[model samples]
Target chain A: MTPRLTAFNVVSLTLGFAFLYLPIVLLVVFSFNESKLVTVWGGFSTRWYAALLGNGPLLEAAWVSLRIGVLSATFATVLGTLAAVALVRFGRFAGRTLLTGMVYAPLVMPEVITGLSLLLLFVALDVDRGFWTVTLAHVSFSMCFVTVVVQSRLVTMDRSLEEAAMDLGATPLATFFQVTLPLIAPAVAAGWMLAFTLSLDDLVIASFTSGPGATTLPMRIYGQVRLGVSPEINAACTIMIGVVTLAILAFSIASKRGLAEPGRAEGA
Target chain B: MAEPPGRPAPLIRFEGVTKSFGAARAVAGVDLDIAQGEFFCLLGPSGCGKTTLMRTLAGFETPDSGRILLDGADLAGVPAHRRPVNMMFQSYALFPHMSVEANIAFGLRQDGVPRAEIAERVAAIVRTVQIQGLEKRRPHQLSGGQKQRVALARALVKRPLVLLLDEPLAALDRKLREDTRFELKELQARLGLTFLMVTHDQDEAMAMADRIGVMEKGRLVQVGAPAEVYETPATRGVAAFVGDSTLIEGVAGAFDGAAARLRVRAALGASSPEFVVAAREAPAEGSAVTLALRPEKLRLWTEPPEAGTPNVLEAEVWDLGYLGDKTLVRLRLPGGGTVRVSRLNASRRPEAGLSAHQRAWIGFDPADAVLLTR
Candidate 1:
C-alpha cells in the first residue's frame, strides 16, 4: 500500500532532499554562470565549458582517470567474483572464516591507512609508482565493494540450478560457467560499475600512490581548488557528475530488468 | 532381499550403504537392489533416509561405508557428471534463463553430441513428454506441469542407464499428480529402463511402483510388492506406516497350525474378545503378539453374523465420515477403544442406515487380519 502523504511527511521529505541536494544544485547552476568568479551568477553562458575544453593538463588527467577506472574495475570484478564463489560454495574449509574476514576487511579500513601502507610497500619494494601502481592500489581497495555486492547475490541464488546442471552431465567447472555465471551476471555488472565509480572519484589513495605522469582527475581538481576555484573547474565538476550519474542510471536499469524476470535469482 | 526369479542381474545395487551427518545417522546400512526394466520406489516419511539413499546413488552424497554398484561395476569415486545416471529434482530445477529447448539440449551438449543429433533428440523427448508447443518459453513463464515435463525431457534426452526421480510428482497439484503418475509409469514401461523414485506417498508408490521399499529411521524396514507389503507387513511399524490399521495388542492363546488365537490383553471391550488370525508360524502359548486390522478389511454388520462367527467383535458406532466414494464408520468397543471400518458407498444412499451411538457388530475373516509378533 502507498503511504499517506501527511503534512508532517511532506515537510520531512522536502527537508531531507533539500539537505542532500541543495549544494549540488547550486554547484550545477554556478557552472553555467557568465562571470569569471566561481560563485557570482552575473548571467548564463557556455564560455566556461568552452574554456574547460581547452585545458590540456585537466583533459589528460581525466583520460588517465578513465583508463584507471576501467582497468581496475575489470580486475576487481574478476577477483571479487572468484572470492565470493569460494566463500559461498566451499563450505567449512580450512581458514574459511579467516579468509572471509580478510576479504571484507578493506571495506571498513580507513582510506588514509590503506593509502599510507600501499605507499610504504611500494617504497620498500623499490618499484616505480606510476599508472600500474595507481591501478593496483585502486583495485585492492575497490575489490571489497565488488565482493560485497556479488556475495549477497550469490548467497540468495538457487543452488539447485547448479546441481541440476551437474546432474545433467555438465562438469563442476562447466556448471559454474553455464548455470551459475549467467544467473548472477546482473549483480556482477553492478559491482563493476560501482568499482568504476569508486576509482573515478577516489582522491586520498590516488594522491598517495600516483607519481610522475599518473595524476588522476580528482587529484587535479583538488590541486586547482586549493590554488583558487574557477568557472572552468565548476564546468569540469559538472561533467564528472554527469558521467557518474549516467553510470548509476545504467546500473539501475540493468538490475531492474534482471529483477523483472521471475525465477532467475530466487533464494533457495 | 534376494533377487526376484527370472530377472537378469540387478542393474543397481546398494551394498550395506550407510551415511551419517555429524551425530545424526541419515542412512544406516541400507542394502538394496533394483533390477533392469523395473520401477522401484523408496517409500518413507521425511528424514527417513529415502532421499539420502537416492543421493548416494546419484553421487551427490558419499556413503560413509559400503559400496554402490551399477551393472556390477563399483562406483566409488565417480563424480555426478561422469556417472551414467540422471535425476529429476523435486523442485524441477529448470534453468530459469534458458528456453525449454536449450534446457533439454543441455545434457546432450555436455556429452559433445553432434549439434544436429542434439536438436533431434531434444525434439523427440519434448514430443514424447507432450510439451511440443513450449520450446521457446522460459521456465518462469510455464506452469508447474509444463516445467515438470521439461525437467523430464532434459533428464531423458541423454538416455541414462537408470533414471532417479526424487519426489517427481510432489510439486504438482493433487489432480495433476495422479495423472502424471500413470504417464510416468507408462513411459518407464515403454523405455524399459530402470526407474528408481523416492516418495513418501504410499498410495502413489502402490499405484506406480512394481516394488516398494519401506524405510524407517535410517533403515529399510520392509521391501516387497505393494500388495505383499500391504497384505503382510513385517512388523507393527510397517503395518501402521504403510496404511491405516487398528493394532490390538494381545497374548497368544492357542495355535491350530493354520491360525493362532490371540486373547486380547487390552480392555478393548467388557468381553475381552479373542481374535483369530492366519499365521505361518505358531507362537507359543501366552507369548505377546499383536493383530493388525485394516479398516477396509473389517465388515460392519447391522446385526451379528451367525452364532460362533470367527473374529467377530461387538462395538458401538461412535461416528461416521461420509466421503462420497466410501463411508468411514468409527466404532467404539465396550471397554472404550475405537476401531475404524470403511464401507464402500456402492449405492446412491448417503447414509449407512446407522447413526452415532448405535449398536453394531464388526467382523473380519481370519486371513484379512495380519498377526505380528514384534
Candidate 2:
C-alpha cells in the first residue's frame, strides 16, 4: 500500500506480463519470415501463411481441430454450467462433495494420465479412436475449465434474481431460463471461449485418442515439429494469437455498449 | 414473469408454513394472509428469516410443511415461473446482456407473450418507473437508483400477484435510499398491488407497510400496525431488533386486573427502576423479567428532583453525545448501569446547563417502560 510497495508491485506485474507474452510477440514476428527455418529471418514475407494454407494435410487437420474444438466447447459449456448450478444451489443428498471433486479432477490431473486412461476406457468399450474420441477427451478437460469458471460466477450472482422472477409469475424452470441463465450468460460465454482455446491447443490427448485421418491441428503441428521447426508453425501461432486478441476486444466492446451511461455503472 | 395488475385474487398466503436448513429452522409455522392490494413488510434483523420467508414466497424454497396459497389456490410443487409473482431483487439483478427494454420484456418473451404486447407493457412500466428514455441502456450503465427502477419495471411489467422486494434500498447512499423508499411506498400505493418486502430496516418497514411482521430467529414474533408494535412489542427480540432501546431486566412484582404492574430491576448495576406498567403479560412477583425504555422517554435534570419521582435515580453525567437537533446525555446511575436522556437543543447555550461528567438525575413517566417476560 505504500508508494515504494506500489512501485514494486507494478514492476513485478510488468515483468510477469513480459515474461508470459514476450515469447508470443517473438513468435508473431518470426511468423512473417520468408525462409523455411524459423530461427533466421531471411526476409519479410507472407509466404509462410500461404504455405500453411496450402498444405492439404495441415489444412485438413486444422479444419478437424476447429470442428472438434467448437463441438466440445459447446458440450462442456452446457454440461459444466448445469453442474455448476447444481453444486452451488443444491448442497444436498449424499456424495455432494465427492461429485464436486470428480467434476474438478481433470483440472488438476496430469493430461497424459487423463488421456491414457480415457483411451484405455474407449478401447475397452470397443469405441474406435477418431474424431469422436478426441472430442470426448477434449470435453473431459474442457468441462472442468468451464465448470470452475461458471461455478464462481454462479456463486457470486444474486440468488434473489431467480426468486424475483418466480415471485413475479415464473416457475422454477422459467426462472432458470429467464433470470438465472441470463444473469450467468457472460460467465457461460467466457467459459465457452476458454474451453475452445484449451481444446484447440490440446495435443497429447488428441494424439492418444485419435485414429488414422482424425489428427487434430495440434497433433499435425506436433508431428511437423518433430522433423524441425518451420515458419509455417509460426504462421499458425500468429493466427491463434489473432483469434484470442479479437475475442478479448469484442468482449470489452460488448460490455461497454450496453452500459454506456455514467449513472448506470452498477454491475448487471 | 411479474403478473400484470389485473388479477382477481389475493396473491400469496403462507399457511402454517415452516422451513429448516439442516438443524437450523429459518421460518417456523408462519401463517400470513397477504391481501391482493396490500403492501406487506417482513421486518427483522439478519438471520431472522425475513429473506428466507421472501424466498419461499418467490418459490425459490419450498416449505418444510404446510402450503403456500396464491390466488386462492395451492402453489404446491409449482415452479417460480408457473406462479404469478415477481420480485425486485435487493441487488437489482438486471440482465447484463440485455438493454433495459429487453430486460423488462424478458419474462414476457419467455411466457410466449405477443411481441407487441411485451413492447407496450415494457414501455408502460419503464415510463411508470421513470426510466423511459433509457430503455436502450443496459443495466451496468445505470446508477443504483436507476437500476432499481429497471428492476421494478421488469418485475412490474408482468403484473404478478405479489412484488417481493429484498432490501431494495439497502445499497444506495443514505439520501438516495431515503428518497427511493418513499418512491417505492408511493408506487406500491398507486399500483395497489400486493407488495411484500423483506427488510432489516425498521424505519423503511414502518414508512411503507400497511402492517409490519417482525421476525426473530425464523419466527414471526409480532405482526401489527407500526404504532401497535412500537407501543407494545410482543417479545424482547422484536423490541431489540426493531430500534434502539434501553433494556432493563426485572421481576414481576404485582398485578391487579385494572392495571397489571411489573417491578423490573435495572441491570446496569446500581439500583433498578420499578417498571410501573398499566398492563403486561407477566406472571406473579419474583419472576425474572426485562423492560425496554425508549431513549426519548427519559427526562434529564441537572438539579436533584424532589422525592416524588417514583422511579428516579441520582446519576453522574458519564458521556454527552450531541445531535444537531438534540443532545443525548448518558448518565451513570447509582446502580452501575447508564441511562441515555435526550433533550432538544432549543437554545444553543455554550454550557447549556449540563456538561459531560456533571452530576444529574434521569427519570421517566410510570408508563414509559414495557415489561418483557423474557
- Tell me how many clashing residue pairs each candidate has: 0, 41
TM-score of each: 0.95, 0.82
Per-residue lDDT of A103-217 in model 2, one digit per residue for the tens?
Answer: 9988889989998999999999999889999998888889988788778777766665565555555666777886677666767887888888888889888888999989998
Q: Give the TM-score of chain B in candidate 2.
A: 0.92
Model 1, A62-121: lDDT tens digits are 999999999999999999999999999988899999989999899899999999999999
Q: Kindly report the fnat of each predicted structure, to 2 decimals.
A: 0.65, 0.51
CAPRI-wise, candidate 1 is medium
TM-score of chain A taken by itself, candidate 2: 0.86
| Candidate 1 backbone collisions, by pair | none
Q: Write the per-residue lDDT of candidate 1 for residues B230-282, one digit (tens) a residue.
A: 99999898999998999987778767763444444433645567777777677
Report the lDDT tens digits of candidate 2 across residue range B136-228.
987767787888888888888888768888888887889988888889888888988889999888999988889999998888889998888
Which numbered prediction scores highest in DockQ against the true structure? 1
